[model samples]
Target: MNLREQISHYIPYTTQETKEQEVILKYMDTFDNLLARENESAHFTASAWVVNPERTKVLMAYHNIYQSWSWVGGHADGDPDLLQVALKETKEETGLTTISPVTENIYSVEILGVPGHLKKGIPIATHLHLNVTYLIEANEEEKTTVKEDENSAIKWMELEEAIEACTEPDMKVVYRKLNDKLKNYK
Candidate 1:
């Protein structure tokens, strides 16, 4: 099946999130593109929370745009392989070559409103991420590098600490739910 179809088929673990994802899926006609920016509107995005093997810590970046510590991820940019997009962004952003999924199932999904920010020196208006999240594992003892263009810092944080580091108002709810699910996962 295609990536959009795969997202449509994904069953979120929570009824509320499932409903939110269904709503986002209904917006897929505009979401299925790199140009889906819709004049400061929503677009499809793929992201991940990279955890340690023991699942106690998560890898996060201090996002330049959001100006807060956030999960590792990026835009789908017309790429239908969102799962691959998540994995690829993790590798590119964190320089981790061995990240692997905790499960093939989706870790979470949301329709996130992104505040307007500058990208590539251009001002981007506020937008939405018809966002999908995944849980992946990476080695903490392994080295990491900052993708300076995107983030100022990248490091391994205790899962609780990561949870606390989420400063985005809407993302706090998403993080809490994601944390609860992660606990149930392993």
Candidate 2:
């Protein structure tokens, strides 16, 4: 598949992502429906590092489950178009009507550990996310609607502010990579 090969071709830029790539690729090779959220063991997820049209700010959501500011994204849900997943998740979570990929190529990838948490009155065990990242360019003027079930608020923030706003230590590297890469994006 295009996604599989693309991910394989993506050279990790950080030592952390580099080390995790082995585990990510192992799961990728071992699973058929690895992108499905219901996989439980682990699965693919698509995330957006959303930037304003002027490229001055990044968008983030106050995640209900994580209880912290984070990039907008969701499970692949059986879909391999991770870019589409990122776009859909951005709009669904932030109500941004104007958004397009900065580039169609894979921006970043990592194996992320999701701590056990309860959702919808059910308990979910700890899992890993083969998280793929993409950069999106969106208009700052677009009105955003809250995704009440997933997030309490959504806002465009400066890169430093956005990174510091997140409380998850593991996610910080993801955000930093996105931010640093995006700085060089046209």
Candidate 3:
């Protein structure tokens, strides 16, 4: 299915998601290249809520720009298949070759705000990430290495500890919601 149809059919887990879902769909209509960062103001991004088989732990990366532990994801970069984007990012960011989706459906949706920051000495303007998240499972036994350009460290953290380790207040809520959804997953 196409990105619009996927988001259209998604049953949001929160009012936030429902609201963001609406905005995402509208943005899809309003922008010419919604999947690429060329639009500048807002663009599509994909994230993986990586978890262990038992779902008791989450794989997190210490993001260089955010300066905090965060979920692994990246820009859609013109890719309409956000699931493939999410999966590819999970491997690149975490250095884990063994990872797979828990389901093909989107696990959550959010319109995330990005503060303007310098990356590789170039200043980036503030923008919005029309973020799509997928639930992914990885082998905890596989060793993880960080992608130096993006993150400084990577680890498998206990679910609650992962929340505590993340310094972004808004993301803590998102993480909590993702963890809560685990009960109904699978």
Best candidate (score: lDDT): 3
Q: Report the Cα lDDT for candidate 2.
A: 0.87
Candidate 1 stretches with Cα past 4 Å from truth are: 29-40
Query: TM-score: which candidate is best?
Result: 3
lDDT of 1 by residue, 120-159 (tens): 9898887778788988989999888889998888989887
How do the predictions measure up, each by TM-score? 0.90, 0.94, 0.98
Candidate 1 residue-wise lDDT at 179: 78
What would the per-residue lDDT of candidate 2 be over residues 73-159, giving only the tens digit for each residue? 999998899999999999999999889998888788888888899999899999988888888999878899889999999998999
Quality of model 3 by C-alpha lDDT: 0.95
RMSD per model, one decimal: 2.0, 1.4, 0.7
Clash tally, candidates in order: 0, 0, 0
TM-score, candidate number 3:
0.98
- In candidate 3, position 103 carries an lDDT of 94
Clash pairs (backbone) in predicted model 3: none
